[model samples]
Target: MHRLILSLLIASLAACSHTPSVPLYRQLGGPDGIQDIVGRTLTRVAQHPTAGRTFKGVKMPFLVDSVSKYVCKVADGPCVYEGENMVRAHADLGLQGSEFDVMVSVLREELDRAGVGDAAKNELLRRLAPSRRDMVQR
Candidate 1:
């Protein structure tokens, strides 16, 4: 009986290991989830006088779509992200590292609220890593 129980436990563990990792989009609730996070992050940025000015008059729809596309692709979804590369898109923003940090904080909060897991967050970070060069004015 003990041997049988041990075999069962091993099988269970093996099954768990074989289960594929969840994608960031699915973990965060897909399109709707990313929209929610983007909205919250935008609101937080807008509420702050200093940070708000950076995105003055910038509409959220475009931003949301781009984010959703990229995240979807990164998270193993089937969408193709065809948006402009970060350097070309944001090169003129004159953003600083501090400003980027603020955005990261707000992003984390929104993701946390949306129930994105740590693994998903890490994946998002990896996907967004390249944007740093373009996002930061140096």
Candidate 2:
């Protein structure tokens, strides 16, 4: 009886250890998927007529990497975002509401194009929505 109880306890512990919920980063396809989305979004945004102005003369690779890390952190992934905060980062850009909207639209399109599930996409957007005020400088 003692051995049986010990075995049952061990089995339950193992099961619990293996049953951790998946993080959003994994749902977004891990590091690779997040990088792809950020890269494509920045590429298209840089080429946009109205939104392109902010990206003028910016280095693409660095921006992509930084933004990817930031997004991963936001999604509860194991990434360290050492970049500036939203308000500090965009403070000098003088970003308008229209430009911010364009960015959000492009991000939505990229998320859809990447085949992200509706739930994951919506969750990410919901998590990111609060940052808009810091990004859009009136």
Candidate 3:
């Protein structure tokens, strides 16, 4: 009886370990997915008059490179995000909470349109939600 109980406990523990966390990179289809989403997002944001204006005089390529790198790193892909700190990056931009919220919402929509699975979406959002805390000016 003691041996049976120990075996059952071990089996349960092993099952739990394989239960699976949503992978940040794989669900988005890895590197290709990230690039696709980036393109769609840039188009969405660019179409918005306000956001389009915000990009004026800003180094667009640099910004996109930074975004790609950041996403790649977060997704556990083989890339380094050599961008400035989140707080410093947007410090002078004077981003508003509402604006950030709109951007995030738009991003979510793009991800869905790209057929990103719910698990991946939830996991990615879980990872990025904290950024809003620092992005919005008090």
Candidate 4:
């Protein structure tokens, strides 16, 4: 009886250890949710004095779609990003740290407006934070 109980305890512990947590994509409400967040963020970015200049002459629809894909993929969603890599994409923009900071602030605002929880927002931002190196040329 003692051996059997020990085996059962070990099995229970193993199962608990293997349980999978929800992915960030699903936590953010999947594709539709990500799309909504991106749309609102872009609208804010377009109105931002510093960030808006970077978007001039850019096609809004394509930009939106690409951003949606990129965010979705980064969040571990089912979508794959087909856009240009960050380095190549932002290479000619001559972006500054201030501009990137402004964009991130706008993104946080949009995420909050979309009802994203702090944990989810932080996770998403953490995933995106690495791109700053590529985006900030100045």
Candidate 5:
């Protein structure tokens, strides 16, 4: 009886010590998932009346790839973003507060469409929130 009790205690301890290690990137579904969210968000934002003007003359594929890499990096993934900083990138665009808000709304919708959980979606948005000050000049 004592031996059985000891074995049970040991098993319980082992179970308690096992911690799952899931990164935020994996929670957001990794590179492919990040790409999907970024692409859909950009496409939607480009169609929006308030935000579409910012996308004018931009190269879609390059912008998509760059934004994907940025999102992946922000989500704690393995990709490195090689694009310009947010401020420098948006310096010429003269973005307004409403335009930024429109993009955020579109991004939130796309994230939902991609089936990302509320926790992951909120966390990603929280991380990216600081960039608004840099992107929105007006």
Candidate 6:
């Protein structure tokens, strides 16, 4: 009986180990949720006194689509990001740290508005944190 119980425990542990948690993309409500977050974030950035100037004369629909695709890919969704790499994309922008911070703040606000939980938000932020180096020149 003791041996049988031990085998059962091992089997349970193995099963637990094999269980896969849902990806963050699905946690953030998939494509629709990502689109909503991106839309709100872009709107806020465009309205921001400092950030707005950077977007002047930019093609907003293309920007929106690219950003949405990037976010979706980063979150492990099915979408693919075909846009330029971060360093290449923002290289000419000469973004300042403060401007980057403002953008992040706006994104955070939109995420919260989308009802994203702390765990998911933190996870997403962690994934995006590396892009800061590419985005900020000053």
- TM for every model, in the order presented, reads 0.77, 0.85, 0.78, 0.86, 0.87, 0.88
Flag regions of model 2 displaced more than 4 Å: 1-20
Considering every candidate listed, which one attains the maximal lDDT?
A: 2
Which portions of model 5 miss their true places by more than 4 Å? 1-19
Segments in model 6 whose C-alpha atoms lie over 4 Å from true places: 2-20
lDDT of 3: 0.77
Of candidate 6, the 10-residue stretch with the lowest lDDT total is 51-60
In candidate 6 the C-alpha lDDT for residue 95 amounts to 93
**C-alpha root-mean-square deviation, each candidate:** 3.4, 3.8, 3.2, 2.5, 2.7, 2.3
Stretch of 10 with least lDDT, candidate 2: 14-23
What residue pairs are clashing in model 4?
none
For residues 1-138, could you state the per-residue lDDT of candidate 3 as single tens digits?
A: 999999999999999889586567768877778877876786677567665555667766677777877877777778688888789887877777767776778879988998998878877878888988777784
Q: Between 1 and 6, whose lDDT is larger?
A: 6
**Considering TM-score, which of the candidate structures 1 and 3 is the better prediction for this target?**
3
Order the candidate numbers by TM-score, best to worst.
6, 5, 4, 2, 3, 1
lDDT of 1 by residue, 1-138 (tens): 999999999999999889696666788777777767877787788677676666777776787778677667776777788988777777778888878778788888788887888888877877776777777895
lDDT of 1 at 11: 96
Candidates 4 and 6 compared by TM-score, better number = 6
Answer with 2 or 3, whichever has the higher lDDT. Answer: 2
What is the Cα-based TM-score of model 4? Answer: 0.86
Q: Using TM-score, give the best candidate's number.
A: 6
lDDT of 4 at 82: 84
Report the C-alpha lDDT of model 4 over 1-138, residue by residue, as the tens digit.
999999999999999999598899887879988888888888778878777898888888888889998999999899988879999999999999998998899899888888888999999999899999988988
